[model samples]
Target chain A: MAFLQPLIFAIVTLTVFFLAFKKYRVIYANINLGKDEKIAGDSGTRFKNMMLLAFGQKKMFRNLTPAILHGFIYVAFLFTQIELIEIFIDGFTGIHRFFWYVLPLGGFYTALISFIEILSVLAFVGTIAFLARRNLLKVPRFHMDEMTGWPKLDGNLILFFELILLVGIFSMNTADMALADGKYGFAISGMLYPLIDGLGDTTLHIIERFGWWIHILMVFGFILYLPASKHLHIMLAFPNAYYGPLDGGANKGEIANMPRITEEIKLMMDPSAPMPEEDPNAEPERFGAKDVTDLSWKSLLDAYSCTECGRCSSACPANQTGKLLSPRKIMMDTRDRLEEKGAGLREHGADHDDGKSLFDYISTEELRACTTCNACVEECPVSINPVNIIMELRRYMILEESNSTEEWNLMFNNVETNGAVWKMPASDRTSWINELEAEAEAEDA
Target chain B: MSELMASGQEKEVEVLFWVGCAGSFDDRARRITKAFVKILHHCGVSFAILGQEEVCTGDPARRSGNEFLFQMQAITNIETLNAYGVKRIVTTCPHCFNTIKNEYPALGGTYEVIHHTTFLQGLINDGRLKLKDGGEFKGKKITYHDSCYLGRANGIYEAPRQLLELLDAELVEMKRCKSRGLCCGAGGAQMFKEEEEGKLRVNQERTKDIVESKASFVAAACPFCMTMMTDGIKEVEKQDEVQVMDLAEMVAKAQDLI
Candidate 1:
C-alpha cells in the first residue's frame, strides 16, 4: 500500500475532477438554454464591480453582526487555504511541511505559520457562530416557509463540514507540535498537545496521519458537494458579483432595464416607418418570458447564483406585509424549475421537452404581490434581481395570457381608452388648471 | 405659453409644469396642485401649463405591468410635448417627475424634468423665492416622509429636507427616514389596487414610526404618500393632531401664497 500511494492519489483526483466538471458543464449548458443577454460590455467597469462586491463583500455588511461573522469565516478560510497548499504538496510528494524548505525563508515561514494558525482557530469559531445562527439563534431571515427541508439542512451541513475540517487541521498540528518537542507557531494547536502527552511516538504518528487524511478527504468531499449545495455561492459569488450592473449610477442597483417593450411599440407607432423586414417563416418575437428558455441568460445565472440567504425576502415589503410573494422563494422556484428541466435534457439529450415551464411553479398571485420597489434587488448580497424575474412573468401574463385581476383590467382599459389610470377622461387631465385659475380669480377679486 | 413661444420663438415661459392625473383629479391632491401653482405665480417663474393637452404619463400603467397601455399614453404625451418643443418640465407629482425624467427617455420623450421640491429649492437658491422668518409653522415639529420614487428611486432626499429647513419648522426625522424609509404602501401602483392580506398594512406600520417621532406634521413629496399617510394617520385616530401636508403646501402656507 505504501508503493500504491501515487496510483491511489491519481485515481481519486481524476474521479473527483471528472464528476465535478461534468456537473458544471451541464449547469453551464442549461444556463445557455436561455435567450442571449448582453452583460458582456465594459470589462473595466465589470472588473471594478467584481473587486468591490465579490472581493470586498460590499453589500453583506447591511446586517452588521452576520456580515462580520461572515467576513470572519470568509477571510480566515482563504488564509487557511495557504496551509492546504502545504498539505496538498505533502500528500502528493509523501513529504510533510514541504514548503518549510522549498522557499527556505526561515523567519517568514514562522510568521506565516503563526498567522495561519490563529486564523484556523478563528475559522473554527466562525463556523460555530454560523451554525448557532442557523440552528440555535434561528435568524428570522434564515428561516422562511420555503427554506424548509433541503435548504435548512444544506445550510447546517455547510457549517458542520467547515467545523470538522478545522478540527482536523488543529488535531494534526497539535500532534506535529508535540512531536517537535513543544515548539509551536501560534500554539493554538499545542494547547491540547499536553492532554495526549506520553502516548508514545507511534500513537502520536497514527493520530497525526489520521487527522491529515481526514482533512484532505473532506476537502475533496466539499468539491463534490458544492454544486448540489447552497454552498455553491462559495464559488458562484465571484462571477455573480462580476456580472452585476457596473454602471454605479444613482439607480445602479436597478436591474429592471430590460430590452425595452417601448422600442418595438415605438416602431409600430411610426406610421410611415416601413414594417420591419422579417423572414416570413421566423417565429414571432416573444412578448414576455413564459418559460426558462424565454428568460435572459442573466436570469438563469441568477437562479444558479442564489445562495438561499433570504436577505431579499427579509427586506421585501411585500413579504413583510404577509404577502404570499417571497423573493427568495421566487429564485428557489426558478432554480428548481431549471434543475427539473435540465435533468430532463441530461437524461434524454437535447430537444427533450418536459412540457412544463417556470410558470407552472411560480404563481400569478406571487407575481402580482410584488411592489417592484426594488427592495429585493437592493438587499440582495449577490445582486440577484428577483424583481426582474417577476416583471418578466408579469409581462407574459399581461401580454400573452391577457389574464389579470379585474382592478388591473380596469386600469389597463382606462390607460388604453382614456390614457390615464383614473376613470376621468384624458382631456380632463388638466382640469386642475381651470380650478386653480378660478380660485386665483376669486382671490384676486 | 403658445407653441411658438414654447419653441423659443418667444421667451414667455422657461418650463412646462406637468400636473399629473392625481393632481388634476383627486380632490385632496388638487390642493397640492393649487399650492404649487401659487408658489410658481408668486415667484413670477416663467412657467406654462400643458392644460388639457396633458394626459397621464402612464406611470401607474407601466408599474402595474401594462406596458402596451403605458407606451400608448407615453407616446401621445411625448408627441404633444415634442410638438410644443417643451424643453424643461416641472411636476408637483414625483410619479410624473420620475416617469417623465427616467422612463420617457426610452420612449423618445427626453426633457429636463424637475420635481417641485428641487425646483423650489433651486428658486430659493437663486433668491427668486423667500421664506418668512417666523411663519405660522415656525418651530413646529415636522417630519418628511420619503416617497420611494423621489428618495430611493432617484436620490432626492435632501432637497425636500432643505425646503423644510427654510420653512422654519423643527425638522425631526422618523426612526426610518431617507434611504431606509418604509414605503407608504402606495408605491408601484399600489395606489390603484387593493392591498393584499397581510399581518400589518405597510402605511400603518409607517404611520407608527411617524407617530413615534411625535412630529405634529408629516411632510410628503408625492401625492400617493400624502394619500397613504393621511389614511394611516386617520387609522391611528391622530388625524386631528397629526396632519399630512405636501412640501409645496407647507411652503405656500409659509409664504402666504395659498
Candidate 2:
C-alpha cells in the first residue's frame, strides 16, 4: 500500500505536469508564429507601468466593489499556493503536515497559518459573492455578448472549482486541528470540527487524507486547465504588462508603437535614404496585418493574456453608442483564430496556411466601428490594447484591400491632391483670413 | 497679422497662429477665428498666419486610416514651415493641435504648438488681455463641453475652463466631465462620414446630457464639438433656449474684442 501510494502520486504529478507543459509549449510556439516586431520604448517605464497597473490593479479600482472582491480572491489564491507546495511535498514523502516541523519558525508559524486561515475564509466568501454577481445578480459588465457560451461556462466552472478547493482546504484544517491537540490557526474551521469529532481515529485520518488529496488534485486540474481558460491571466498578466507598448499609457491618447511603420514610411518618402535590397524572387511585403502571422508577438501575447473581463468593451465609446465594435470581442476573436491556426500548424506542421485569419472571425463592420478614442486601452487593467489590433486591421483594409467608406475615399483624394480633407486648394487656405481682412477694412471705411 | 502672410511678405513672429479648416471655412467657426485674431491684435503679441503657405495637418486623413495621404500632407507642411524657420504655433482646433503636437514630431516636424484656449489663458495670466468687470456673460449659467482631443488627448481641461472663468457667468458641470467626458460624434474623422446605424446618434445622446444639465450657454473649445453640439441642440429643438459658443468667442465677448 505504501509503495502503491508513491507510485500513484508520481504518475498523477508527472501526467498533469506533462500535459500542462505540452500546452505551454504549444502556446509558446503559437505565439512565436506571429511576425517579429519589437514592442519598443523605455523598459524602466514599462516595468513601472506593469507594477502600477497589472500588479497593483490600478484601473480596476475605478469600480471599488469588484476591485476589492477580485483583489481579495487574487491575494488569497496566491497565499494558498504556498500551502499547496507544502502539501505536494507531503504527498511525495508519504508524510503528513510535514510543514509543521519544516515551517518551524517558532510561534511565527502559528501566526502565518492564522493569517492564511483568515484569508481562506475571506476568499470563500469572495468567490461566492463573485459567483452570485455573475450568475444570480447578472452584473451588466459580466454579461457581454462574447461572454455567452463557453466563456460563460468557463466563468462559473472556475468559481465552482475554486469553491471545491476552498472546501477541501478548510476541511483538512478542521480534521487536522481535531485529530491533533492543535497548533496551527484553525479559528474558522475549528468550529466545524465538532460534527466530525465522533468519527473513529482511522475514519478521521481517512477524511483528512481525502481532503488533502482533493485539494492537491484540484490544483493540478487547474494548472492543466489554465492555457484553455481566461484564468491564464493568473500567470500571464505580469509578462503581458511588461511586454506592452511603452507609450500606450493610461492617460490621454497614448497608443501602441508604429515605430516600424514610421521608419518604413520615412524610408519610402526620403529620397536620400538608402533602400533595402529588393528580393525579386521573394514575396512582396504586406502593407498591414492580414493574418495572425502578420501581427507582432506582443499582440499575440496580448490575445493570450486577455482575462475576458469585458473592461475594454464596456469602456469603448463605439460599443456604448451601440456600434458593432466590442474591444473584448476583438481580443477574444484574435485569440480564437490564433488557436485555430495553432491547431492547423500542430496537425500539418511547419507554419501551415489555413486559408483564414482574424478577419475570418472578426467582421469589417466591427473593425470599422472603433472610434479610436482609446477609452478601451485606458480602461484595460491588464494593459491590453484592442485599438492597436483594430488599427492594424484598418491599416490593412485601407492600404491593401482599398476597403474604406466613401467619405474616407473622398478625404483620401483631397489629402492626396489638395493637402486637406476638403477640396479647398492650398491657395484657398488663406481665404478665411482674406474675409477677416475685408470685414476689418469695411468697418474702417 | 494675417494680411502679412496673405500679402506674400516674409514675416517673423513668436507664434504662428493656425486657423484650421473649420475655423478658416465654416461660418460659425470663422467667428471664433476672428475673435481669436482680434484678441491677438488687442494683446499686441507678435503672431502671423501661414496664409497660403499653410496646409491641412492631415488629421482626418490619419484618423480615417489613409496614412499615405497623411504623410504627404504632413511632409509638405513641414517643408513649408521649416523653410520659413517657423518655431511656435497656436491653433483653434484640437484635432490640428493634437496632430501637430503629437504626431508631427515622429514625422520630423517639431514645433512648440499651443491650443488657442491655452494661449488665451496664458494671455489672461500675463495681463495682456483684460476682461470687463460684470461682462456681457455675467451671472449666466454656462456649461463647457470637452472636445476629446483637447480634454483626453491633450489633457487641456483647465485651460478651457479657466477661459470660461474669466467671464462672470456661473460655470456649471455635466455629470460626465474631464477624463470621463464623452465624444461629440465628430471625432475620428466621423465629421465627414455618415452616422453609423444605432438607436441614437452620438450627438443626440451627448445633447441629452447637455439638456439634462439645463445650462443655457454651452461653451465649447473645439470647432468639431461646436458643430456637433449645435446640430445636437437643433435636433432637440433647444436652439432658442441653448446657445453654443467657442471658448475663444466667449473670451472675445468678455474682452469686447469683436
Which candidate ranks first by DockQ, i.e. highest?
A: 1
Question: Residues A1-445, candidate 1, lDDT per residue (tens digit)?
Answer: 6646656766787888899898888789878888877775587788788888778888888779888888878888788788888887776776687766676766677677777777777777778888888889898988889989999989899888888887788778888877877664534765778877678989988888888877888888999998787778877778887887664435522334334565667577776765666789977877777888888888888888999999888877788888888999988888888888889988898788889989899988788877766667767888688877887788788888886788888877776776666888766766666676778689889
What pairs collide in candidate 2? none
Considering summed lDDT, which 10 consecutive residues are worst modelled in model 2 chain B?
A: B1-10
Across B14-41, the per-residue lDDT of candidate 2 in tens digits comes to 6888888887767888888888888887
The local distance difference test score of each candidate is: 0.80, 0.80
Runs in model 1 with CA error above 4 Å?
A1-3, A252-272, B1-12
**Stretches of model 2 off by over 4 angstroms after superposition:** A2-6, A245-274, A441-445, B1-12, B166-169
- Backbone clashes in model 1, listed as residue pairs: none
Give the Å shift of residue A426 in candidate 1.
3.1
Error of 2 at A429 (Å): 1.9
DockQ (C-alpha based) per candidate is 0.52, 0.50
TM-score of 1: 0.94
